[model samples]
Target chain A: MEEKLSVNHLLGIKNINQNDIKLIFKTADNFKTVINRSIKRVPSLRDITVANIFFENSTRTRVSFELAEKRLSADIVNFSSTSSSVSKGETLIDTVNNILAMKVDMVVMRHPAPGAAVFLAKNTNTQVINAGDGTHEHPTQALLDAYSIKEKLGDVKGKKIAIIGDILHSRVAISNILCLKKLGAEVMVCGPATLIPKYIGSMGVKIEYNLQNALKWCDVANMLRIQLERQDIKYFPSLREYTMQYGINLQTLQNLEKEIVIMHPGPINRGVEITSDVADHNQSIILNQVENGVAIRMAVLYLLAMKKTENVKN
Target chain B: MKKRILLDSNHTKIMLRRIAMQISETHGNLDNCAIIGMQPRGIKLAKKLLELLTEITKNKKIEYGELDSTFYRDDFRKGDKFLIPNSLNIDFLIENKIIILVDDVLYTGRSVRSALNSLGDFGRPLKIELVTLVDRKFNRELPIQPDYVGEEVDSRAKDIVEVIWAEENSSPEVWIITDK
Candidate 1:
């Protein structure tokens, strides 16, 4: 049973197959058990070194990747563009190549430009894990989200998952849609017309305008954070009006006859994307998503490290 | 390529009864003792041993656990094949209890070494005893040996000694194959 992932680099959720997703989930299951133990570190990647290269500002994603690397017992090097030679106009390839000079085995990268991780994978020989690239795809986030869904609901198949709030500027939304769809879940993207992407319909997901209607029809609702930093022009007239139209609150959940699982990729915009009460609701799996993030990232790194044995195979 | 029967099902059952009696004689009533099966293949041997142990000592029973040592193995990235892990189901505590670590074959002594390392996670055991269906002699890479063995065979390191214990294809038997 040589159950390995199809792709070498975790560029995005779009680049991996269904079996790759399943393999990742299966590996994550073991790591999940390890993390809950008295001693939470594994010696699987003891000889490997991973560098986290972030060309953008982040809190949760950066910390999650770092913690995942640490838990695997892998030596890690963290680089943020604001503090590195990147601020002095050093190219991505040159910066990464310099780190590679130090014998780094793998890279977990988040860049402001889309396809930056893809370009890095092409130029470098080491395995590249896309932490996040622009608003393209956060594959690990999507993976952890699906894993959490499976953990909560027993399975991801035949589940109706509604992705609410800003869809156009979320890598998490794209990755989640691709992952959930691959796992045989029904996905529906909901938001204001301006905040939603025009190309979303091509992804084979249902589009809905009414928040209450979408909520009533789905088994899970994943609320996305509005990327105000990436927004140049006004997508909506006012935050207050957008909250009134798209935000999920305790009332929205209570009005439904069936309870729905609530999820958020963190650094949540409290009253804007989801109210405090709903975010902390009993049915909310927001915290479980955070813990699963480490396990999922560990699985990705460990599987990719398994590829290194193949490097010496020939 | 070749095949040989070291022990048939009838002999295997009788050998299991003898080993179960030995275990009962060593630790009478099985108090403060537990049975642990190394995962992937040792689980089958462990299950059979537990059934026989229960039959012989009807009043005493031991908790059974499946331990996977893939993560603790010294050869993580050093091997040609990737280590695929099996599920660990050691729910009961092994603290201060005797653990009879069971496996199908004892070769290289590496798996047993890693298994000993893995047993540390589920609390410290008072002692650990090794049990095996076959022990490949004169091919040891580490200073380790099984306490209880059904049979010991001497063969070339390059040759293969396979134990086909039914279910998948043939009946319960062991084979030693050499390249032509």
Candidate 2:
């Protein structure tokens, strides 16, 4: 049997295969041209309306998704968790249903609970795009990260990528691991023993605790932010100890034999996971990742809208 | 399957020269005129025509752009198969200028209509004209006709007319592939 990418709902990176990722990259390539033009707007989604429902705090992801929707000419309605009825004890289903009653064509949601997106997809009548779901997955972020690597290195296959920092609680790390491995990249996770998951070896990834060796062995290093709010119990003794063990500083980067590209899914704790000099270095493609995020998201929303239009026709 | 070769590489060259002369005779000197091609296939014809026009006018400057109509189509997303968009590379302004829209073949005029809608984002033009290599006269669903044509052919609903270029096809030939 042949597997096909179902565009009904973009729940997670696990739901899509490598070909689907390639297709998104191809579409995003076209959109990158659209954005560079003098009139950086298209009427492809003019007939459609989208609702951005963020049940968690975000600055970059929310803004990226909103700009993508606007560039597609889709009418957007922004709903924040602080101002929305979700704070008044309304269930997820009821809040979503009320929003749908106003006639929204799609939903881009960010919730703090894992599997929240899957639950919405199973219950909602509209198309669902997961912005982020707890510590489960941030598929678009992973996609943009992969895209940035492709743009810089010209390919993702046969490249070594080392993910550093809080591996256990970072949704970006899990999604990037799945995405990079699927694209045929050698992936390794390096962090403190407590921060790295116990059963991650079952998922077929090399776990490394020594940051220097990991940096030397990899072509690219993606630094993840340590989520202090998400961590319930103390995973490590102190921040200073963790920084000394795993932090990517200018001195360590200068000691490397080859020039390695650096990446960080931002809201960076500066000196904790990555130093200021390394983050602003010439090899760092962090800003490129942010720019590609809009294109990746535009590709997702456009393709899913096309699928939805096809369904309506039938 | 039955195939009929309408124009070979030599005939294609001659016809392209004739089309260029016809365009030159009408516009005199193409200073404010821009040649825009419908992407995926029209690009080849437009490029050839632009080169010929440049030669005929003794190296006069002319603008050439490619427009992708995938997103502008009215029937977009209505098909069961996935739609892949082509590259759009129009960098020049079209406002108050003569626009020559070029394509390989003019059939139902649906693609031209889509191109018109897509061109709205980049300023409005003073005038727009259609130029095609092959005009399938009886196949037009809309009341549209090309102003400048290289050849006229009669094709059935099941017959496919293909313009093969040296860059893509093994040989440069204009032929019709028919279902026998």
Candidate 3:
């Protein structure tokens, strides 16, 4: 099989087809083995350097990408919005170009503005990976989520996935829907009426406002983080009200007809989006998702680096 | 294109069986020996050898695994062609065990080098041995040799040696193709 990935940079899941996703998952499979080994490091990208350029606050994605870079034996330079010259009113392109002048091979970026990665990709010669661009897309997160689903359920095709909560501002939800749908899985969005986008149903996803129906219908329920930081106006009544109607608790999970996998894109709102009991349930693969994030990011970096080197050879 | 049969199905089976016997002779009872097939083509050969060894010795205690050397290769991202990685499915620890690395062809010895690096990531082996079905003599870029070879074939740079297996083809045949 030819390893030529369809895209140079994973800007969004929207541009990738089933083959590309499968290829990433396949590459992730090898990386998953690498991480589980005793040495847990490969010199595949020994000379290559990666930059984790985060213009927004992050814990898992930043740390995961750094760890992936380290595990691949790639040189890493981390840039954060607070510490970088962007705090001194330096523009995005100027900052990235300045970093590129230092010989960075790729940039894994998360910015607060939507299309931030796309903008940087257009402006820079270095490869741009969209870690999270506002609520636009976090392609790696989506890939890891899909990979985790495939891991837990043995496959993703023909499986029912309900992405619950904060659909309006959840990049994880958007990316997961596209990824799951691309992999032949049925995806439905479940959130409050105000929180769910009006035309999200047009994207071939069934919209369910009720939590019980969503949980009952899905083989996996991915509860997205409610973006309190991104919200300018109140989208829901209160945390208590949202938790009462939409939160995934032990009682709600026990009431379901069959067992379903629980997922969260983390820094969970605890009692708000999911209760502690259900989050700690053996069925919840939140930590597995985080662990797979490292492998998935490694796969992404490794494949993109291969393409870059192949292009250089050409 | 002119094709010459280096080994037919019968010859291939005999060679594999002889190699299995040779392995059993070296490490009797085969308890601590782990057979790792370098992936894609090597895996098929390793699986066949493991089956034969198990049947001949009636010892099903030998550990067998497949190791993909794509990520461990030095030419991984340096080539014009995109490199697709194969499966690495080793479940047991290779620590302090006699490791037999199996591959179908030994041309440049780079693949075996990568396999050694990959095996290092797993665990330290007590002793490592190389087993190749077709040992292309005089084509090595590195100082690596197979401990067990099925057939030592001398071929030019333009010649292509291929192992046609029933797993991927209609019949098993080793063909040497030359442009005439």
Candidate 4:
């Protein structure tokens, strides 16, 4: 039988074949080689247009995607609610159709509404790449994080990865859990009692309220950024209480194995989810995650584009 | 089992020379052009083409590189695990250079996909044209067509077309062997 690339369109890392995984890694390797060179840009996707439609506020992800698109020689159009017709109370489908009418080849979108990218993909002929959509998923971030982890610690299979912080609200945590689990890693979601979801254990992942116990069992510790903006919902009583009970600090680091790698989906809260020292440590793959983000996005874009072309030809 | 000659070594060399001339004519000159051979038999063909081109144009600056597509292959699951070889020797930058991607045969076009993937690792070229020694019409999975073709042959799925160079097989001939 012909081997099919098993990528989950929604969850992001579902059933991705080993060959396709190797392809992504290999592509990322190529991008890494060109990064330090004089001409960083490649004319691989010359004349191809990519639109970034961000319904949510973001600085890093939006900019990184734009840079990645530029590096691949793709034309980019950045659309946000602040400047676009979205401010004039335009329907998502109408706005998307208008953008699609311009003959853009792909859309890398981030929406406050969950599964917006999936919905757009179902409706539009253009390729829909999920950048981030509410608390549902941020697949590229998860992919980059996985790439970083794989680069640092080799294959993630059989490795213990503890995802810490607010699991209930973190899109990063959801994505990480799905990605890590798919890659055959033992995933553990650990945070405070109120912050951790009740049914999270049903996802075939181990759940722990105590960070100390989770730290002991894990080879990699991924700290999800505590969304301070969502604090009004009262998931936890106080920031101090959350930090003292569930935060990854120096004391927590000292208690754990030295070989354990540190990770964070950034715009870090500094002392809330993870300590400043741990974040700056040698074992931390936070910065590498940022670098890998571009490559992973490139791989996603390339694969999706290739699939589209194949469909059109067929 | 039966074996039949497809194209001899001398015929192969003559075809490559013709291809080189055709390529030279198409690109105006061999001034800013380079030839990259996909490894193993393709490297031998590339070397022969390089010599033929050099004799034709007397331009020693025409670059030549070897490309190993083992690492970049799309169907790694189907490939032999122990057959992977060392990487290619491509010293010069491929940027803005018209690259002629040379291979032994065009069968499934999957190898060409891998070759493209591998080529991207080095540098982006101005234009890429594929040149293959044999064009076997069977089953093509990818949408890739060779710019230069040596010989076109129709074959069944059970038959394997073998191109034996003088360097490897001593008796230089292209043969199709069908095993049942």
Clashing pairs in 4: A6-A15
Predicted structure with the largest lDDT when compared to the true one: 3
Which has the better DockQ: candidate 2, or candidate 4? 2
Query: True contacts preserved, each candidate?
Result: 0.53, 0.56, 0.88, 0.00
Which tens-of-lDDT digit does each residue in B1-180 have in candidate 4?
A: 989888887877678778888988887558889999988768777887788788888888889998776545554323223222334567789988999998887888978897887677667889899998888856577889999998888988678887777574232468899875
**Which is the better candidate, 1 or 4, if ranked by DockQ?**
1
Task: Give stretches of model 4 more than 4 Å off.
Answer: A1-11, A14-22, B1-180
Please write out the lDDT profile of model 3 over residues B69-159, one tens digit for every residue. 8888888776686777887888998889999999999999999999998888887899999999999988889999999999999998778
Individual DockQ of the candidates? 0.66, 0.50, 0.76, 0.08
**Which prediction has more favorable lDDT, 2 or 3?**
3
- Residue B162 displacement (Å), model 1: 2.2
**TM-scores of chain A in all candidate models:** 0.98, 0.97, 0.98, 0.94
RMSD of each: 1.8, 3.0, 1.9, 8.1
Tens-digit lDDT track of model 4 for A87-206: 889999999899989999888899878778878878877777788888788877877887888899888889899998888888888878777777788999998878788888888899
Provide the global lDDT of candidate 2 against the true structure.
Answer: 0.89
Candidate 1 wrongly placed segments (more than 4 Å)? B59-61, B167-171
Clashing pairs in 3: none
Model 1, range B1-180, lDDT digits (tens) per residue?
766666787776777777888899998868778889998888888988887887777854478889988878888878776776788888888889999999888889999999998788767899999998889978899999998888898877987887677763222476777875
Docking quality of model 4: it rates as incorrect
TM-score of chain B of each: 0.93, 0.93, 0.95, 0.90
Error of 2 at B113 (Å): 2.8
Clashing pairs in 1: none
For A1-314, candidate 2 gives per-residue lDDT tens digits of 12124667888899888988988888899888887767788778888899999999999999999999999999999998899777789999999999999999999999999999999999889899999999999999999999999999999999999999899998898889899989999999999899899998877788999999899899999999999999999999999988999898999999999999999999889999988999999999999899999999999988888888677877
